[model samples]
Target: MSLGDERESSGGYGGTGQTRTRLPDTDPDSYGTQRRGPRSSSRGLVTVVGVVVLLIAAIAFANRGDGDPADDPTTNKPEAAATAPTGKQPVDAKAAGIPTGYAHDRQGAQSAATNYGIALGSADMYDLEKRHAIVNTVYAPDVATAQLPDFDQAYSGESFLEKLGLDKNGAAPSGQTFVSRVIPVGTKVTSYSDSDATVALWYTSLFGLSGESSRNPVTESWYTTTYRLKWVGGDWKVVDFTQKEGPVPVGRDQRASTAEDMTKAVEEYGGFTYAR
Candidate 1:
């Protein structure tokens, strides 16, 4: 829906009535980043498409944060079938230290699917070195070796960087810091088995193009990204993935923050291990 189509609607089964809001869908292409005279330009014309791309960047960066991905207790346990030897029950852990625990069976697969989704959509993918670290961390050893180079080529290409309005290595243009971040709102297990699973992640992504003369400026989007996961090398690793537009709600009518504030928030506030 277009941003101009935003409306408030409320009414439900419980009769308590719930109002649903939606973000305005601005044009993704027209805006160039040029703050007018130090005052933030209020061009409410960013597209819903841009938001999804930024979500990928956000998740990628957060995945590279401190601590070990393997050590996450939430997704690290063995399946109940393996533990029980009978292969009938499932295993699950909701431990605090874990990224987000899962049951040894389908639950574990679903959990893996969700966490992997976060990793895949993160910002670390922009940096070759960090991108390698993330691919290695999340994928099976063989898969990492074989797929890392491909991912490297795909994300590191000059054209790809330019498309996002970045330099050869994906650096933001002068005076502008790129903000591509994904915040997973929630996840759902669509299908699963003992060794595989498919999960749908509902998320909000932000992509910024904040400097003067920027070809690509900052924007936000909401969408659903799904990951098909497999149990590999004793952990859940992504095998395939895809993205789609959302059942996105309308955005707030609050005043937009300045470019500087947006930049600071991106730098200062880190992402989280999403749950529920």
Candidate 2:
């Protein structure tokens, strides 16, 4: 039998009618002594109908205001169109291991910026050859050629590598795993044209080493990066970019994960090519 049936069969309040009670009427004159007059009952019915009519009128008035709640400046409700998805399919091609073939529009520009942010912040960017490939794939030809040396210098410094617990070759120490990943939270197009666009990407990143003996355990940081993109060779390519510290939210009260779990997660879970 089901648990409910078993309970019913156990002779408790579920099956028995003994728990019911009939309270005494509030009107002493109508409690097993006298009946209410027809006039009094009719009056109560009229009162109830009047109250219902008032409630309906109030509701109608509330609904007939100047505009929708979303349009009202004082309301906290956001416009539906702001958050609605555009329903555009994600790009299905990659060039130099980065997503490519974005549409020539605002949404496409945002998509390009988002994916470029992820590529630039990834651990692969630490490797010189992979870094060069990313620079060429994501930047306009002239910009890439101009900035390649600067990028190389910035990422190749031994001091920078040592700070992140990596060796001169940007490889983690033996038995340790290095992690650098950018997860785009949102994207916005600040300005757009047929050939050029400016977009901003707000993102969080996981960086540092994950291992038992590592001094720099992987941690999260938030930032916003703005990209100036130009349509070059039929794709959105970065011409220039800048980054700043986050519009960070307050951290939650949660215990940190063990280094082993972090390392395992980084190894097991693959990242995504973000699009808007």
Candidate 3:
């Protein structure tokens, strides 16, 4: 889904005038083991594109919330009470999993959006198997069934996977780790209703092709991606989403971290259950 085709610039990190690697040659057996129908794969590709766009929206929203002239009103408020309620918490999580299982209330919708935002931007999504699981888990049930096959096709494409420095099923080389991680900074409910809600998910993403022969090495970018969700099938499922440039702060000249440090930080830093 994230083609990494072109380099664009704005906010904290400037584009380095480089694009990620290209996909590799196709093997006929690549899709032989796939369990999806052609129509299903088409729907899955749409879901992947939608998720990618939503991720960009979350980054822009986070960077915007970080202190921008245009975002003064939203920023001026005292930050939401950091502590969540003690009982019947609207939030929910599976043991040791990314906090995605949310309730159906306004807070629940916001929480779902935020959590799904993390899952969408995670490094795991780059892998073929993991990407399939993520799409099935994060999207509404019906949407997942209709979309998973296509997502599988898109990511499994020889050229596309090659671009990300991955093999079929999106796996990186033995000694190399493919990095596509999202770090959620916070979340805010821009608007809400009983059945529909718009939530702003703020976070940063780590995306690039990383390996010895990699064209695009690991690099980090800040952004905020927002989603419009609908309470469907007893959970909050994304109905639609959009993205914009950013509320990114001026660039800082902090010394860049080493590739190893960046990789370690990604592995060590876990995402959060964001709330307004």
Candidate 4:
């Protein structure tokens, strides 16, 4: 879903569909930071794959401080995770099949925030009733009640869905494919404590419709979703979260794909449960 122009002007769903209008050039806000430009140059997806590598390095530097790896202007040194295996493994099973029960450590907190980013940024957030289940599943039980009403407005807000070419229920019309997905690229620990931690999950999101005749055709947008996480009942849960624009690279102009082809690609490519 490439909503570059439209989203920039209208302020598309920034981090779970709040009433977002625009992003500052590069300062922190209530949600996210600045706005992301379109990925029109060359093959955007391929470029996205490459950007993830740099983001991994950026996360390492942020955690370890503006240290050795990034200090030298010429040294193309690798970050800790890129240099060697961290020995951590993905959780095999899920709580309600959602990859829960994270370790009570720094790495574990990072892992939990990454996975929850995927869950919250998912298409499930669009489905009115289904959205509730996702909130209850990943968000702490205490704040979830207060959060639901705001979510209801964002996801089911009357003309908002219409603008994206979705039906009242957030579905694409028959024969059209609606895509709302988040692909996590990196993670960083902003702050951490035994019971509380702040982490940011960097990722790309796909939103809009995939159909030959669609108006709001599928678009790609970059985002960094920051989460205020809490260790609860032996797992990390989102106490609060925010979304901001990007550090997107300049895109190289390229031929656009056909609607049918875009739809096919989206269908064939499955989403993965991201881990740190």
How good is model 3 by TM-score?
Answer: 0.62
Q: State residue 232's C-alpha deviation in candidate 3, in Å.
A: 2.4
Give the CA lDDT, 0 to 100, for residue 220 in model 1.
69
- Give model 4's clash tally: 14
Give candidate 2's error at residue 189 in angstroms. Answer: 0.8
Judging by TM-score against the true structure, name the best candidate: 4
lDDT of 3 by residue, 112-197 (tens): 88777777666676666677677766666666676566455545567756766677767777765677766667677889887888
lDDT of 1 by residue, 160-252 (tens): 566566788878877878766777777788887768777887877776565544444556677786666777656566665555677677554
Per-residue CA lDDT of model 4 for 1-276, tens digit only, reads 222232343432323444342212221221111224444455445432344444443433334456676576445755446556563678776854468878788788888888877777667778877788878877788777767776676667556677666788988888888877777788989999999999988777766667766665666677777788898887888887766777565644444567788789889998776555
User: How high is the lDDT of residue 103 in model 1?
Assistant: 49
Q: If ranked by TM-score, best first, what sequence of candidates would result?
A: 4, 2, 3, 1
The number of clashing residue pairs in model 3 is: 24
Error of 1 at 117 (Å): 2.4
Give, for candidate 4, the lowest lDDT window spanning 10 residues. 24-33
How far in Å is the alpha carbon of 228 misplaced in model 1? 1.3
Model 2 agreement with the true structure over 1-276: per-residue lDDT tens digits = 001111222231111222121111112221111211223333332222334444443422334476677765546746456565764568999988899999888888998999888888888888999989999999888878877876676567776666666788889999989888888899888888999899989887776677777766666667787788999999999987755667777554345677778899999999887777
How close to the true structure is residue 82 of candidate 1, measured as C-alpha lDDT? 47
**Cα RMSD (Å) per model?**
18.6, 28.6, 18.5, 14.0
